[model samples]
Target: MECLTSFCETHLQPHQIAPALKRHKLINPVKNLEDRMCKKHKKPLELFCRTEQMCVCQVCTVTDHKGHHTVPLKKEFGEKKAELGRTKNQMQQMIQKCLQKVKEIKHSAELSNRDAEREREESEQVFTTLVRSMQRSQAEVSKMIGEKQKATMRQAESLIKELEQEITELQRRCSELDQLSHTKDHLHLLQSSPSLCPPTSTKDWPDVSITQNESKWNVQKDISQLDKKVRRALSELEEKLNNVLEKSKGDDLKRMQQYAVDVTMDPDTAHPLIIVSGNGKLVRTGHLEQNHFYNLKRFRSRVAVLAKEGFSSGRFYYEVQVKGKTGWNVGVAKESINRKIGGLYPEQGFWTVWLSFQVDYEACTDPHTPLSLKSKPEKLGVFVDYEEGQVSFYDVDTRSHIFSFTGCTFTEKLYPYLNPFDDYDGSNSAPMIITPVNQTP
Candidate 1:
């Protein structure tokens, strides 16, 4: 029993000793706890994490970074967030500016397009208006030209027809002459037969031959006269036709304008005077006041006639006032003189102004002829002058020059003669007044 108890004690007790030895070799839990506590409570890494763009462990910070400022992870994250916010704001502003610029460009383009469209429309309108106006003018001109052409063609056709008719008449006359020649030959053969012969008949034959010859001479004379008349007619027709052709070819007809004037003559009454003719006949004379009393007469003529001898070639105007004491004849006279009259007249022309009084009319070759002044003529006078190259005749009613010549004179006519006073006073006639057209001074 004692041995068994010893064995059990030794084995069990040995296990117990091992346990105690293990306990003795183990580290101290309190120390390890203290170490972990130090690690947790110690300062963080003092490194410039933001500057380095990296995070460092506490051990690395303590080893590598001495006396350097360090930042917390949260603080770094806050800075990055603030930077990102600023960048985002700037980007937004840039995007807005870009959008605004794009919008402005679009608006400008639209305005430019509108302006171009308007200009194009205006150009098209102007072109269309011009074309329409040109077309209208062209149509008018074409119509006028067509009418003129047709008229000319019709006239030509008429002339051709007349010529053809004349040719046909001449052919007919030639045929008739041929037939008459044949008939005369047959009659001569019959007359030669002896059965047709008689002594009394022979005398009658001679008389008949004389009558035939006379008839033939009359026919020849008639033919000559007809020929002359036909030639004259042909010449006149040719001349007229040529004139028409010339007028058609020239533009003179299109460029003609007419101007007219009128003239009146009157005698002066204030100053009385007398005139003695070469035949010892007394012509009536009277005193004539200036621009007061005168006779009046009217005459008519064309502008061309005035241009031939008058001064004013272009269109002109005039007015006249006349005062007279006695009645006198006033009319136009052709520039023709009776050889029996001594008056030497100008070439054959027309004078729109003339005055004639009773005169001892004796036909003479003298250029100056004095006719009797009849009908209680107190004064007889005429005034003539040219102004602005225009020739005018005036009759003095008063001594004043209030006279105008509106009539044309193709030839100089009997100049009006005025006697201011009779031989009782022996004074001159009243002074005449004259003025130029379009003249102020």
Candidate 2:
């Protein structure tokens, strides 16, 4: 069959209006006008098999499609056309919904990108300020040490000058006495002896010495202290950064608590002066050193212990109670940490914080970083993300953060480390207790 427009263009001749009546009739031609015959029987497919859903001739209904539900081809065609119209409408609605979803996803992605960029900028700024502060602290410490050395040297130089002057005066007096002794005249010699009974000195020199030890200062000790000050400054900056990030989002305690695990002390790794309870949860310093079986892994100096459980990957959290304790150290340490030389810092695979005299709170960085908290905490929560290399501390009582050590590259398994500082007159006798985690509401 030929399309109407093509037929009109070829037969109607140029400049002809083309008959509208024929065009309109062709557009709405009756359905089933064309005879579609099945080749098997060469018969027109005038009937439809509803069960088979295919066009069929009358003979097919009686033979191949025998006993099957059948309807007129035109009637079935009308129903199917109506069904197609409904399907088209549903397809259009689905397409519209998918387009809206695409828009929403794009908007969310844009917001996420913006947040990431802003956070990146903020982190850069914070680190820059921290570096500057550390540099200034280093300069100040160096200047102070240099000035002390100069002052001591100046004092020594002034004493040397006064001693030289006394020696010169004594030498002059000896020379005159020698010249008088050599004189031929006895009267002259006697007069000289009377004058030189003793060279009159302004002051008596009795046991005067400028010992170097008295003027010497422990440069390493001074530098270590100054390093602590610098670390404290850095810690504060980091705390502020963490707070800002947390505030922009929400508290991370709940998320961290999800990884909470029970921690117990390992007696084998403990110092002889340290005692771990049978349950492994409690640890305290002993007044008298216990003669336990000799162990190579035992702490040699500081009274500290390591937990039985060690983590190599993923996150973990634990809680400890330090109530009534005057001094204590609690945190995590790498498995390979030198237990023999127990009092270690982060650089030496020990990441910890300590309380001294129940007043001073500090983190054991290379140079101990002092923490200034709003209030002392009896119960503390520790969180560690091994892969992320983050160790954080929280004051569980106030639900406030204490400090966090980040940007570490962990290779070995890390275990919880604890230290019950030496008991001095029983003032620091309280145990560093590891307690069960009671999730905060």
Candidate 3:
């Protein structure tokens, strides 16, 4: 003010001066302000440019930020603080969700450990039973051979005793002959000779010999009988094992149904001859192509369709009805299965069970093995454990496992597969209907 001379320095009031000015810029005071100064204009940044989302001076609103919506800095600060509070609440909710998931994962781990222990105990028992059966069979066979050997020893001992007795009698007879021959009187000798009569006991010593025929053991016969017995025992064990396994399968089916998924047919993937229902639950082969537009995803030759959903992880289950279908295949196939040409078998990325027109059922494996199902499954259940790499088919009505494809390596997503074979002679024209799963109690 003294330099300008419009107001005298002597007239300046020290009470109006800031303390920072006297303290040598402890904070910005009078001569040079801080970052609050607008770079373009030498004015304080007092307003927020709402359009640019930044602090601006009043001069900046008319210059770089012309015709911009501006608000007081204090008002924008309050709004931003409220938004941060809302974000904090959202983060807290997310953290709670994460914690809840942690608890679920821990519970699942506990169940898995329990199941593993059960399987371990069961396996040990089965192997132990098998070993005991073999040991018992071996002991029985050994004891039979030992009895044969003992019987032979007894027969030889009896022969040795008889020979010793004969030797003693012969020796006694010779001694009596010697004594009689030495007698001096002829009358004594004649009397003794008539009494001796060759010391005959009416038995020939030359004919008395040990039996030379050796006792032969029919060991091969015993071994064969033991083999047959062991095989029979194994067969019985197998039957028992199957009964136990089927019972367990019934229980497993109930657990598997918990992962049941609603499956709908993917019409885009259906073959031209296949007619998909409007609700996407059923599909059947028609007499001729239904004039549908050709889609690249469709199965060109095979009369098959895929479910709309595909799974890449975890377990899933679905059921289908083939009550009247004589020739159909139901199971799962990988997404990369050939849409052009190939047999629908495991080699072609299909794990399925099939029924032919002659009512013959088989699993479509590499060698196409036959299946000895007790009865045809009117409704079939397909279960896939993606991480386990297992695909199983079950007889839904009977609650029995029909077949399982195990030890697979699935790198791609798998889809539910349905194949109603070509309607040859119209005997196998029934539609395969996707049905809801009814879990076993």
Winner on TM-score (1 vs 3): 3
Query: Which candidate ranks first by lDDT, i.e. highest?
Result: 3
Count of clashing pairs, candidate 3: 0
Clashing pairs in 3: none
Q: Candidate 3 at 292: error in angstroms?
A: 2.6
- Which one is best on TM-score? 3
Worst 10 residues of 1 by lDDT: 299-308
TM-scores, each model vs. reference: 0.30, 0.46, 0.64
Local error of candidate 2 at 40, Å? 2.9
> Candidate 2, 52: how far from true, in Å?
1.0
Per-residue alpha-carbon lDDT of candidate 3 for residues 217-292, written as tens digits (9 for 90 to 100): 3655787799899998888777766666766677678777877999999999998899999999988989888777
Candidate 3: residue 292 lDDT (0-100): 70
Q: What's the ranking of the predictions by TM-score, best on top?
A: 3, 2, 1
C-alpha local distance difference test of each model: 0.37, 0.79, 0.81
Candidate 1 on 342-395: residue-level lDDT in tens? 322223222222222222321121242343322232221222332222223222
